[model samples]
Target: MTPVWKKTPKPTELIDRVTQAFRLAFGYEPTAVYSAPGRVNLLGEHIDYSGGTVLPFALPQRTYLAVTPRQDRLLRAVTAQGDAGASASSSPREIELGAIAPGAVEGWLAYVAGVPWAMAQEGLVSRDELPGADIAIDSSVPLGAGLSSSAALECSTALAFDAFAAANTGREPLSASDTGRTQLAIACIRAENEIAGANTGGMDQSISLRAHQGSVLAIDCRDFSTRPLTVDVDRAGLALLVMDTRAHHNLSDGQYAKRRAACDFTADTLGLTTLRDYFESTPTLAEAHQLVARWEEQVTAGMVDLPPQTDLPTARAALRHALTEIARVEECLALFSTAETTEQTWAQLGDLLNASHDSLRDDYRVSCDELDLAVNAARAAGALGARMTGGGFGGSAIALVSQELVPTVAEAVASAYERAGFNHPEFLLASPAASAAQDR
Candidate 1:
């Protein structure tokens, strides 16, 4: 595992630039800066929202915010990466407290405005009691790359505001007993979920909140609980490769909404509050199948009639596959804790990955030609196992390979993709990285 505290100049540069901008715009120096890291799901996909287990690690990429309170109820923001010359070059605008609403600001400013409005709505902060500040935002996370970039942005902003509020008012911060890091972390997560309209599980925020060096966090999204599992890959000369398909996928898209809706329907149909509730009391595959059957019947009857061309049987099979995949994720976590050798771990991990892809391809129907090609090419080129990693409708895939074969495997996949007339994909070698922390 790579050390979380690797000396990187990016954060230092971001802090300096933000401080300079804050001093120039607000005529005051920022006392503190906070940062939150984007995360990648190493195993579980679409499972967080399903109320299942997820294993996510913070990426080195992060969003940083430098803050200083103001005497007025005006909020001003400047971006490290400016928008067009107009928005980027323009001096920070003093946004009226009342005017900050959905669509109040365009582009990334929406997030800047939305954070304050959300906090106010939750009574965490009031417009009348707003902490006036000039905040400068900088991020290295790739936007729309299926990584949790939005979460990083929202969490960092929330933390900066929370820290400023606590300092200025001399009031104990939310979840802070004067200075409890754990409490502050929870507060940050709440700010993002309640204030930012993200309807997200706690995975991103928790990883951002409690990431450590040389470990991958296996998080239970249901209770916001985490257990750090050390990833010792170097002994085996293995590399975790993340391939960016460059295909677009949006969380707010209808496909995501539909999958969420299906999970909800599954809970309601089973007379349960959530899928987690249903899974806990039922242990056998037979019982699981029965539950899925009942839910499928309810869904089919209530929703649009299954199209004649559509295979309802396959659809039911897909739901069962998802349920099984959820169980497999739990098993995989156990394996991660006990597996002795890297190859042993890779084999177990790869089996699960292959199972997941089969489910996505046949059951969920979310895999695309490009995704399949990448997975196939990697596996054919000596990858132990590979699968599409995200909410897959054209996102990226991850492949498990030994270090010696990485170059050959990546090249083979790219070549296969090119020959198929698809755009060549960008491949990255990533490992379990540290989660978010306060930048001093």
Candidate 2:
């Protein structure tokens, strides 16, 4: 078992390391550098594509991109972390900017090559007009943790390209304004979906580009509008502990795609634009149950078709998770706004977190044994609330605990993993941090 805790490197340290890697790889200094943080979804899971609102905050762990524009049309990329799994090739990968397209690049380089292509598709820039760059990638965000490390890579690359475009046209940096950040996020999402072949929703990219320090960003996937709620964990005497099960998950696996497809199928069967169209405002847990019941009634009445690929029970289960998770997100927002968090409020928040995990584990069917153990152990150790964050399956779970009990909760989870003969879980203390931006 490895160490129980791993610290995310500070900005200065990461910046310096990336700079050195850039120089060593390209044999010249990078003109500029940009960084984007991986994200943790505090609440609301697997409903973004269904147009549900989610609460996510940026992590201190980030991916950094260092670039120097090239006069020619060839784009080249390299990474400092050879086994980061960001790319298949440990050496630099190169492709003509004009040749970049969907499936043009494979493996990790697809993420690197897709940004310029997506920017062109979005009309933010033309592929022929885009400046090629020698790029270096470095990151502290743990791979396969469901912490949105892929988004961090896409977003950092997007910001770097955005800066390149601004400088080429003698315009102000597009990353400077909220609207511009939204555009950059859009480009990143397209790169992930069309180029990388990952069917991710906008939640990850939106939070990576738009999140603020000490606040969680509430995102409406329907419109991609955002509201930041201040979270003072220190003031509330709480610590947000993220425990990585060391059980890696790949979203490109059919698991994530199947869930998204089921949700889409359910919404289409109901004749609603999205499951969220069924709710004008946030629903109560009772109302969420009612919504599920309504779906069952409709199914029994033969109002919708159940394709062989998606059975009635699976559709209903998916809907149940989406509706209930939406409610949990709303509850969190209300709690954050009403007053400073006291012990009672913290407990209430914990209950919602627990319920969210249950829905994901039972109905959504995404929790693995490792995730369940991590959550159960943290709760037994006196965490206010514990749930698996991100896309579930096999990634990380977060526990809300009293600040003073952080060590105790971490040790308990480690002990449980040890007893189960599972990999020793790694831990991180999560705080709301700044969104993606230029580092230097």
Q: Which candidate ranks first by lDDT, i.e. highest? A: 2
Candidates' TM-scores? 0.82, 0.96
Candidate 2 on 1-440: residue-level lDDT in tens?
33378777788999998888888887889989999999999898988998889999999999998898899988999886554454423468899988888878786778888988898899997654588899988899998898998999999998888878887888887799999999889988899888888888899999999999989898999899999887677788888999999898888777888888888877888788888887756667788889889888988899876534877788788889999888888788888896557777788889999999999999999999999999999999899999999987798999999989998889999989999999999999999989998899
Give the deviation of candidate 2 from the true structure as CA RMSD. 1.8
* Residue 341 displacement (Å), model 1: 4.1
Each prediction's total of clashing residue pairs, residues at least 3 apart in sequence or on different chains, is 1, 0
Clash count, candidate 2 = 0
Off by over 4 Å in 1: 1-9, 17-29, 81-94, 101-106, 120-129, 171-199, 281-290, 294-318, 339-342, 421-423
Q: On a 0 to 100 scale, what is the lDDT of residue 364 in model 1? A: 78
**lDDT of prediction 1:** 0.67
What lDDT tens digits, residue by residue, belong to model 1 across residues 207-242?
Answer: 765676667887766666678876665666887777
lDDT for 286 (candidate 2): 80
Question: Candidate 2 local accuracy as lDDT?
Answer: 0.87
